[model samples]
Target chain A: MIQVEGLTKYYGALAAIRDLTFAIDRGEVIGFLGLNGAGKSTALRVLGCVLLPTSGRVTIDGFDVVRDPHEIRKRIGFLPDTPPLYTEMTVGAYLEFVARLRGVPSGRAKARTIEVEERTATRDVHDEVIGNLSHGFKQRIGIAQALVHNPKLLILDEPTSGLDPVQIVEMRQLIKGLKGEHTILLSSHILSEISQTCDRLLVIQGGEIVGQGSEQELATQMGSGGYLEIEIGGPSQGEGRAPVEKALQAVRAVAGVLSASVIREEAHVAQIKLDAPAALCPQVVRALVAADIDVMRVGRGSAQLESIFLKLTQTGGQPS
Target chain B: MSATFLIARRELGAYLRSMIGWVIIAGVLAVDGLLFNAFALGGGDKRSSEVLSLFFYFSSGTTMIASVLIAFRLLAEERQTGTINLLYSSPIRDGEIVLGKFLSALAFLAIVTLATGFMPMLVMIHGKVSYGHVAGGYFGLLLLGSATLAIGTFGSALTRSQVLAAILSACMVVAMLVAWLLGRITERPLSEVFSNLSLHGLHFQPFQAGIVHLRDVVYYLAVTYVALFAATRVLEARRWR
Candidate 1:
């Protein structure tokens, strides 16, 4: 449903996105993973028909975003990070307006508004003034506005940003519900957030796409064992990092540990990055325990997505 | 209805719902009344035409100022709040957006301008003003307002913030208003150009005095068209940024 080739956008002297090329089939929810300033938003805006590319070509459902914006616009729905809402309007009224604006016949706007309201589960606050609603509702309303028209492609930028855990789950469920109806391109800086929600991942860095595939595909192709970072706490040791090394080396011997690097050693704790199979994760923990080098906590290695992202996207331009 | 009309209806609904629209109308009415009583009727016995002229005179100034306030929010607020995305992503043309916005503001301004009719009718009761004079003066007011609102729409399209839009529009309208002053200070060809460019002095006066000149009509319409065209270009150029 979407095709892009050599798409680039430059904000005078500086390029926001460069030579981006990707295509998404109908009914697939694709996650755009990148750190902040990754040009994810820039790419989505062009696909949404809101921004014109500096060069290159993009077509959605056979219509070029540049040459036939009118047709392309009709086929896509976009939810920018900040919900574009008229605060003074009631949620119901706003949705109705957007529904009609997107080409819903005036006669059907009422039914369409109600349909979206129920779809996003915002019926309770339908008549409430938008500004008075909480941030979560506003976000849902933003999604509703995009879907009210029932566009073929849904371009959502950081849909879960700035929401509480409960709200996040609600949004996640709502997005999942939209899976079969629209082709979705959702963006997020956090790796795990969209990982479960999307069918495939398109990892970007410095305005360039470094990797694209399913989680398993990326993990296998990225056979650098994925970076596992750990912090060790102890009184003292050789080079002040030997005990941590001994414990990590034990995990390495278990078969899945590819490599481990001590990124930092401060006080009793040390930070380490490990590349290993998921099956070997327990052995790494057991090795640290056996060596008697008190291991604080071990989560998924940072070297997986975060480290790979850093290398893939040279973090020079990423926001602090 | 046309796409333009659909957009206009939504915009008009917005005007009715927002307090700023009513404030502009109420404020203009108050100013128009005060000016009528204080200046037009306050002077000693005078010709009815003179009094009517005075009413049109003060009304023109307030009307122009009101037009700017009404038009300043047309596109700027949409861009500022990020709601312009809805319009941009729709299957609509920039021209429809501009024309829709213009029609909405014009309709609202006309209603506000016409609301002061009771005051004029009062003037007509105790005095003798020609109906042609009243109709001509109102026609002039609407045309002048159309031109100013169009210029304001262009100013609004250039910025995202409503405050900046107001300032830019004020600067543009004031420059046009004072063109006659520039005309007074310059020489031959230059002075003539300035006089012709004056949004008020040269063109509006003929309409205000019940003298309908095709040239004045053409001038206002031309200004309206050029301003709208510029506004459309600004919308298109924003995608590049």
Candidate 2:
């Protein structure tokens, strides 16, 4: 639904985003992953038709961003990093104004406003002034304005930015609920936020696309192997780190296991960090069981994605 | 509604709902009333027409000042608050945004200018006052207000700070107001040019004296058109920035 090629934008003599090339299919939730000042907002601004790119081409559906911006504007909804809200306006009036501004018919604008308010879970504050709403409610209202016209594409810059943990989770659920209806492109610096909500990621660094794929695909491409955490019950007779270390020593001998170390030890349980590909977790578990070590629980660690992100941005990691 | 009218309506509503609007209106009325009572009424036993003309004279100053204050926030405040992005990303053209904002300011200025009608009605109490004079003077006030508001709109579009917008527009209005003074010192064709371009002296005097010259009408409209066109171009240029 969206195609961008050689999208370079410059602010004065400095380039903000250089040679950004990517395509997103219709109905896909695409995450634009980058660190702060990684040119993610600049690129999104170009696509949102808010800023004219210094060079390159961007097309939404079939209309060119430069030549047919008005047409593309009618087909897309954009939320900037800070929500563009009139603080004096009530939520309902603000949504209706945006709906009409986006070309929704006067007769249907009110109904469309309510529909999006419900979708974004902002119905309770419909009559409240935007300035009085909390940051989370304001963010939801921001999303609601984008959705009020029922556009085919939603471009949200930092949708969950500055929200508390609960608000972030609620925003994630809100975005996940929007998955099938519209092609979504959202940007964020938070790894787990993007990983949990996006079907595909376009990792950008230094104004360029360094990597693009699913989580496992990125780990595979970058050879940024993941680790696993194993919890053992009682540590095999409550000895020192020896019995726990010995149990992990057996798991290290399993194929594809790179290293192992004890992360924490307690009265009844111990957590071991196994440096191995997550795909070999089953074999490692079996190896622990063969050594008569009681494995209580096992799960993949989050450090893998963090390493992949760091390598891609900090060291120019290669993409497949 | 069309995008232009919709934007104008919202902007008008904003002015009406905010305290700044009423404050400005009240200030203009108070100052105009004070000048009317002190200078126009208290001086001597002047003719009714003379009193009416003095009323329009001081009213023009307040109107121009109010125009600068009112139009300074039209576009600059949108940029200050980041609400311009909403208008930028919308399907409306840049010209529509500029025209819509100008129309709203014009509508509000009309209300403020017309609210002083009672002052002229008081002139009719003692002596015979020409209705044509009242109509012509008001017509001039609205025209002057419209032209200055358009210039202020252009100024607002050039900056993000409302203070800077007000300063820039006030400077421009002052420059135009002083053109007649400049005409007095310069020679021949230059003097003639400055006099013709004088915002209040050469252009607005006939209307102040109960004559509605078509050239003056056309001049104010031309200024309004040029200024609004410049404001629209400024908005379009911002997309590239």
Candidate 2 chain A weakest ten by summed lDDT: A234-243
Q: Who wins the DockQ comparison?
A: 2
Tens digits of per-residue lDDT for model 1, A50-122? 8999999999999988889988888888998788898988999989888877888889999989999999999
Error of model 2, residue A132, in angstroms? 2.5
Best by TM-score: 2
Could you tell me every candidate's TM-score relative to the true structure?
Answer: 0.86, 0.91
- Say which docking band candidate 1 falls in: medium
**What does candidate 2's lDDT look like per residue over B1-241, in tens digits?**
3899988988998898888899989999999999999998987799999999999999999999999999999999999988888888899899999999999999999999999999989998877888999999999999999999999999999999999999999999999999999999999899999998989999989988889999999999999999999999999888776
What is the RMSD of candidate 1? Answer: 6.5
Cα lDDT tens digits for candidate 1, B34-79: 9999998887897778888888888999999999999999999999
lDDT of 2 by residue, A101-155 (tens): 8999999999998899889989999999899999999999989988988989999
lDDT of 2 at A76: 89
